[model samples]
Target: MHHEAVGRDLSRKVHAAEAAVDHALIEIAALTAALPEARMRAGVSGVTGQSAFDDLAASLSDMTRARARLGGAHRTLAALARRMGLGAVAAGPMDKPDDQPPLDGSGGVTANMVNEM
Candidate 1:
């Protein structure tokens, strides 16, 4: 009975985490669509190039990195929750991802960024 309860608990956690990630992905997608890919790739040339666009680029870069970190952390948590009990999750081919961020970060252009991430 105890083991069964543990399995149930782990299952709940895993399910919740999955839902949270799904929601996060939607938000990330919106942020990605707003970014100007051309400008981001072009970047700014010259030392001390202190322009409004430069600052925006810096902010976006940071945001991308943060998103990557957040995905990693969530995966770690999900792994822990899944491991709590034998057969907590399913025993099958490891087809799921490690929750890696699809985008890379520059620094952190704004609170909303996903493309560079």
Candidate 2:
């Protein structure tokens, strides 16, 4: 009976952890979703060719650059984890680029690449 109670306690702990991770992921999604509009708004304001827009424009641009730096950090940490056999690469080479042509020498036009033109 004591063992069963301990098992139940562990199961509840796992469920709570999973729920917390899910909530964090949802919050991350929300923040990324707002980036595009902020970028566009800042760009349009900056294009007035006026000096007054400089600070806000720079900050908005920095947000994107900072996000890119964060991505690099994430990749570096993920790679380190993979080297230690902790996790797999999040984006493997087998994940195809949408607009790339095939390298098989089939002399075939890739539809996605052709569509871009």
Candidate 3:
């Protein structure tokens, strides 16, 4: 098969993966918000459901690591596509344009950002 065909197939899979990841993150967010609400509804103090809240926080941490790993895989696939001479192909939806200025116009300089470098 041609490289273009392979790139298309990869692109489709990437999009699907991104969607699944996004959905899982959304669900996690919902649960994170709901736990506090549930605790409040139960007329309990914050300490009452501390254990469950801790577990949920741990799960979120695990999911974050998984997300970072997936992001790395996405970058690797992009590099492969370029090496295959497929040029720039759409892999998945981006939350925002990389070139776009940050709302504060600090260009991330003032932001507490994580860097792999």
Candidate 4:
């Protein structure tokens, strides 16, 4: 394949990866916000769906870790692209600047963090 073709393929893959990460993080956030509302809807009667809540929390934590790892992989891929002379390829939209601290190692951006920005 031509160099331009290879670069285009890499850029397309990067965009897809960014979208995946963004969607996963959004889902995680939604779940996080929903848990409390769900518990309230259940009405605290001693049984507060504690077990389910605990499980969800664990799942969210795992997802956060996974997001971090995926972010690292994204960064590595960006580095590889740079080495290949692709230059600075923008993966996706970022509301915050690069200098801002990431919510986690994931480096994943979301509108939820806009207040922090």
Which candidate's TM-score is highest? 3
Residue-by-residue lDDT tens digits, candidate 1, 1-117: 675566556555655655555566556555544445544566734333345446556556666665567557645644453344233333222334533332224533222112122
TM-score result, candidate 1: 0.35
* Per-model tally of clashing residue pairs: 12, 0, 0, 0
Mind giving the per-residue lDDT tens digits that candidate 4 earns over 1-117? 876567667766766876786687788778867878877887875466677767767877887787788778866765565456454344355643563332323555322222243
What tens-digit string does per-residue lDDT give for candidate 3 at 12-86? 797797778778878887898898899889988888878877887888888888888887887687657655655
**If ranked by lDDT, best first, what sequence of candidates would result?**
3, 4, 1, 2
TM-score of 2: 0.35
For every model shown, what is its TM-score relative to the native structure? 0.35, 0.35, 0.71, 0.62
lDDT of 1 at 61: 65
Clashing pairs in 4: none
The per-residue C-alpha lDDT of model 3 at residue 80 equals 71
Candidate 4 vs. true structure, TM-score = 0.62
Cα error, candidate 4, residue 45 (Å): 3.0
Whole-model Cα lDDT per candidate? 0.47, 0.45, 0.67, 0.62
lDDT of 3: 0.67
- Full ranking by TM-score: 3, 4, 2, 1
Provide the lDDT at 10 for model 2.
43
Candidate maximizing lDDT: 3
